[model samples]
Target: SEGKTSFGMSIFNLSNAIMGSGILGLAYAMANTGIVLFLILLILIAVMSAYSIHLLLKSADVVGTRAYEMLGLRAYGQAGKIIAACVVTIHNIGAMSTYLYIVKIELPFVILGLLGKEKDFGGWYVDGNYLITIVSVCVILPLALMRRLGYLGYTSGVSLLCMVFFLISVIFKKFVMECPLKSIDPYSNNGNKTLDPRVMSSHINSDFMATPFTTLMRSHNDSDFIPRFIPVMISSHTAHDCREAKMFTLTPEAIYSIPIVAFAFVCHPEVLPIYTELRKPTKKRMQNVANISILAMFIMYLLTAVFGYLTFYGNVEDELLKSYSASDTLILCVRLAVLVAVTLTVPVVLFPPSSSGFCDKWHR
Candidate 1:
């Protein structure tokens, strides 16, 4: 009965919600749980996330309650409503904080890159405290002020494009370029030796399973038949022929990676609203939207993790972009991409909480 969102816009909005700052950590997740296991976990989480959305939609359809908090009220009365509201509030607050934190830490770098000033500009724009505030006022506040959820889809599409740029950059950097930091690893002799291309390619070919993404459809543990595949970093400056590559051990600590991946795929709070706003408003179409959105994110997440892990190997940092040397111009653009994407994504995340509160007040 309200303004309806078209199928494509719905897909873009949901996908934007599904993809977030959480993706930057996925390479680290892959590092913790080798390339093989990371794919498995990603698929598993995506399947579960999609199934959960289906259940939420089915519940809403059967109960005739489209809002998440309202669905909570239908299922469990006032207590359910309160619990749902609080969960949505807490979830959105955490998400908003993370988005703001991304702006805080990354905005200065983006501005510095644009200004061509490698150093701080010594003003409010450079300060982490004020940077987020400035971005919130200049960027997020306008998007958040929109009266309808569907109106934000245009910005959401742009945000998704930013992430797409990031994914492309990771893939491009992996094949076409070498990070200058590779030659500068302190562990390498003299910090000036170039990796022999032949030696590097040989190791990449030999340990094909564990390195990069050639082994995408395969799985192996240290205890598996192949066992103990190490990533070699060869130094051309050395008279010695081959250096021992660092073996990325399959550790028992894979548990830490699951939550972050799970966090990345979260779009439950926004699901009901999107479903409600769908033009046809059928359960089947909404389910398709959820599936398609999750599938798109699945591909992006796996690619980001695979390429990023391949690029850094055992040295993948918590934030994949941070793994790049600060001076790399290509990486600076990718950083800006993430900042813009997250900046726009904040309002999409913020909408559910604020709208849910309004719905609660109206119900009263």
Candidate 2:
């Protein structure tokens, strides 16, 4: 696999596939859910991502070809081919959908912050060349157009870096750090007025149950009284549905910051390319690449979660930039840059799917 694939390739593929617009949506997931659910979500995603890698490796071993190339063909023949095609197409579509959503969320700010302009938003009509669609196009077409994964060698590096910058910009704020309301929006005074002692005391003294998160949890579970459930059944309920819902939300939150803590656990097909592409001089390097990628992502995600919590505590937005999307310069540059980057990124994702399709026909 060294000369044929290499560890480096795996890293790039992993980064590209896993590191999409998922980052922006995570903060809200964490905040809406709570820390416990967040941790649970993280573990689930990691396990899934790990299993994904294992399955791919196992598939390669069994099929004597890459996971995408023959997993479908071996399992079900031509029908398998169609299913594989759908899987790849769906992945591409999902990637595009995610890109569109994130860009739609991030673009307004980039435009405003950088170019001082705004584009149509999620208010309606997303399919008509929305940001998400455009973003996906940008990420996919250019890279898809490359004709070979080898060409993406450097662009992957930049994407990795961009992911880093994204993490730093969002997180790094656990060291820094809110709530409010009144007829009177106690927080609505525009930040220039002093807090009312009575209100402050009332708020602080209020029951923890009143907290937005607490209220939401109670409301969602419809359980005002917790910790009283049967121990055996706890695993049956909280461990499954509650846990899945919780972590899935935070998995994204924890993705970039605690990169390692979480990256190992994604469930997407993109991880294969990363593992396949590794430099693989030794087991140590292989582990190191995985280790560093996860570590970097962990730190990045942790910070993002923190920043999101601090920046918009009571009402955390999945797309943190939305508030300023209308005038965010950095957001604009990023959108435009990603528009370019995605061009290179999509092909990198599509190749495996295409080859899978060809093999299915050839085998027939």
Candidate 3:
């Protein structure tokens, strides 16, 4: 395809991972740094992404090798070969959370989707690394045997298609379905389990019903109050102009403090890998990829954060995924498609790390 490693892959990666829980992390990110600080952090994160690309380009020029191998030369000299392996391994370890989150969410669904009519795997608890070990043996082992990154090329195309399906479903569902994640409730009786009682109650606090309830009041004036609020407080005219800027406390005594709460799940880490990845090999592509990617990510962040701010801003515990959970059938269908795209792309994002980790562990 034209996009074998082109703009399509960049969009697919950004669409898949840039989203997910990252939007929720950002809700708190804003709450942590405030809107101004949040933007600063975003630019810094984006810079780091750009820098990674710059580093790879420079490295590739020196010894004339791919980014992965270049890391080895930078670190190892003649041992660059070994260093490269270690670098890949370390990268994967950092990305372990992404791997675990995607698998846990998707694998459970697979077992249920294929067999939901027949049975549920919820009861299966073999304990320990038994599951991980088993999966590595049954699943990882086969994929590991593959020859190279090029070997997996076709799957990447499939993953992009899956990503498009995901985008379409969510966008369509948003307009059609009436439920917002906050209002949809399941009933619950046990501490261990429960279902929303919304079905029984005549009253529902639908976001549709609540958006007009009065937007959370941000003061038209931001100058004086911002200094006392937010964690990374700074002197800036922008902060002053941001009327109704939220005032977050910086005191240790403010148990369950707002600034800390905001930064808690702020997902700044995701942009790091993506920025570098795109910069390294794909830097020469159309500028549209960069502009479009930034715009999409920003818009995606805004919609979900608004929901989170409205839904759980003060209560804590990020609301990105929680809001998705609120979406009705159409939304649910979108969620399902997103789940598939994320699951399939797992190997692509995690592969470098997995290869590096396997080699490093093998030597040590």
lDDT of each: 0.77, 0.50, 0.43
Q: 188 in model 1: Cα distance from truth in Å?
A: 14
- The 10-residue segment with the lowest total lDDT in model 1: 207-216
**Cα RMSD to native, each candidate?**
11.2, 12.5, 13.5
Question: Regarding lDDT, does 1 or 3 come out ahead?
Answer: 1
Task: Predict model 2's lDDT versus the native.
Answer: 0.50
What TM-score does model 2 achieve against the real structure? 0.61
lDDT tens string, model 3, 110-149? 4444443334444553222344455556655565455343
> Which has the greatest lDDT?
1
TM agreement with the true structure for every prediction: 0.80, 0.61, 0.52
For candidate 1, lDDT tens digit of each residue in 261-327? 8787899988987887889889999999999999999999999988887776655678888777677
Which ten-residue region of model 2 has the weakest summed lDDT?
230-239
Kindly report which residue stretches of model 3 are placed more than 4 angstroms away from their true locations once superposed: 1-7, 10-21, 74-81, 94-97, 105-283, 286-299, 310-312, 323-335, 353-364
Task: Encode model 2's per-residue lDDT on 4-35: one tens digit a residue.
Answer: 45556656655565555556655655666555
Give the Cα error of residue 157 in candidate 1, in Å.
0.6
Clashes of each: 0, 59, 18
| Highest TM-score scorer | 1
